[model samples]
Target: MIAADSVTVYRGLEIGAAKPSAAERARVPHHLLDVADPAHAFTAGDFTRLARPLVEGLQAEGKVPILCGGSGFYLRALLRGMASGEENQVEAAAIKASLEARGAAEGFAGMYAELVRQDQGSVSTVHPNDHYRIVRALQAMALHGRPWSELNKEARATPPAFPGLRFFSLEVEKEELKEYSRWLSGDQVQLTIHLDKEAFISLSELRAIRSRTPGTKTFGGLIASLIELGMEEWSLSNRTATSLPKPQRDKNFSL
Candidate 1:
């Protein structure tokens, strides 16, 4: 499992970022967590550069890689290649610099308020705690002064890294993570989630939930169970992951 979260990528932000616990990582063998310093911000392009190869490797091993996180921007970049050709790339870089400067000056809370003013639909689409997705959406919206709802869901995407790699997009409807995971378990389902402000869960809550779910000792195990219905779901037997045919479409709730 490769985390697509921007904050979780930092080394010392475990609690705030709701990073997978040490025990959870021990159980699931996750990649790309705690790989950056908190002083520096991790971008969606960086996620794609790192995660694309990791997912490819997992596919080569004949095991489907599960992307578990709340950062829709990073997830979309990983699933659909991040490059948008030369001209778009140049524009993206300029936008990135501008947004980074804004974020640095205004702070996430201020930027988030600005985002709320611009796009309520977008504000409702992503998890409230997903800082990267919120700021990144602002960046994209800035490109043409368009609200997120009016912009194309696909953002300058190219080819996906893993072609013929089907995606299983599931929406866990419950708002709270604790209730949501249990609900999914009771129903015996694995799904991705689209949550707004109240839906975001804290680290302590997630840790408590992990302890309650049998055999889930770490973040990897807990998330794995919630997102894929236990390791048995990945058993060589079931290959029918329901979703779009175009290799992980629906950017909002995709892995």
Candidate 2:
């Protein structure tokens, strides 16, 4: 599933961000996930530059591009538009190590205090445990003697470029959406399962439909749960995939 929609408009950040599990991805190919450290600012520009081509390429190959996440800005950037300013792809590991060293020498709390002193605005938005942001804020301060927070304020004001792209926003019914979210987070899916139209309809009515059919059963129960909640049509393709990895052929097509 394309995480574009899921990443666009969901609350409860962490679990929402972790919407697509490893097993789920093993079944169908996914473009981007966990690309950003939750503490870092993952801008729309980043998504446009990195993810847009993947989505388009998959489409060109006649494969299904399931955009399944809750980052609305990212989805908009890919389809409708993008926010301005290049993504600050800092060396998070290096920055964290530097901060850790600073904290060890002077004090971790003191280092954080220094970050606040340099840029209170960014600090307010960033989590305290995010050493990477703290270090980057400090670096930004050292570079210009002004806080990174102030820079972000200026950056956020700039508008993105993407007015012509089409947007088919999936509007999930409230109660159903809640149940679906729960089902997605749960480990109900134990085996990978791909289905045809006949199989899909039959499985929808029977929770243990796979008992009557032969397919990957890992996440069949989860799919059933999602169907019961009423699936929203964000992006589904009738295109038969021609260029996916060999292992993924069965997932994108009815074999």
Candidate 3:
């Protein structure tokens, strides 16, 4: 199983991210889970770069690879390849990491100033506080080899990453999208928590949480992050009690 979900890629975002259980993984080998640092922005481009090899290698071995998750962006990018002349995701991510590191060391104000100096068009378009776009625009300048905003303006073709790639989507009646949205808006998801059956969070508390944590849009994103971070910390502190290794990054593991 190759997980395509964005949150599940993070090492410490297990419970909230709906990562497969140990028993489930033991039954069927999984790939791409916990292979990334949550601190970094793992783009669809990165997913394509990492997952392409896994899929191709599985085909070479005459085995079908199952990619399961709700990351529509990752799935699409992998099936339909990136546009021509795109930079490799690893290098792009590295460049982004360098830019972010310098932003910290050299002050983001100075970094932003440098960006505005180089590509005022890109820098001017985004809000002053839009840090993600600021770093991304800088990364694009680095990747494009210049601050030429006209470069990507030309039309380009996006082909499938490989010859045999296929895509399948499942849909529900009405997709239940309206109902689901309402539930996510603040209602319980037919799930209950308990401290001896009486220690449940109140509806008001849920409303407050929904209001304050407005970004809890995923079914399990928040829960997974909290549980996995706690587990990782506990394991690190009690190394003598259990033999849980910190999730490894860099290398892509396959069956």
Task: Give the candidate number with the greatest TM-score.
Answer: 3
What is the per-residue lDDT of model 3 for residues 209-254, given as tens digits with 9 covering 90 to 100?
1211224333335445556899999888898556767668757666
RMSD of every candidate to native, in Å, equals: 22.3, 19.3, 16.0
Highest lDDT scorer: 3
What is the alpha-carbon lDDT for the whole of candidate 2?
0.51
Sorted by TM-score (best first), the order is 3, 1, 2
Which residue pairs clash in candidate 3? 15-224, 16-220, 16-223, 16-224, 17-224
Q: How far is candidate 3 from the true structure (C-alpha RMSD, Å)?
A: 16.0
lDDT of each: 0.60, 0.51, 0.62
Tell me the RMSD of model 1 versus the true structure. Answer: 22.3
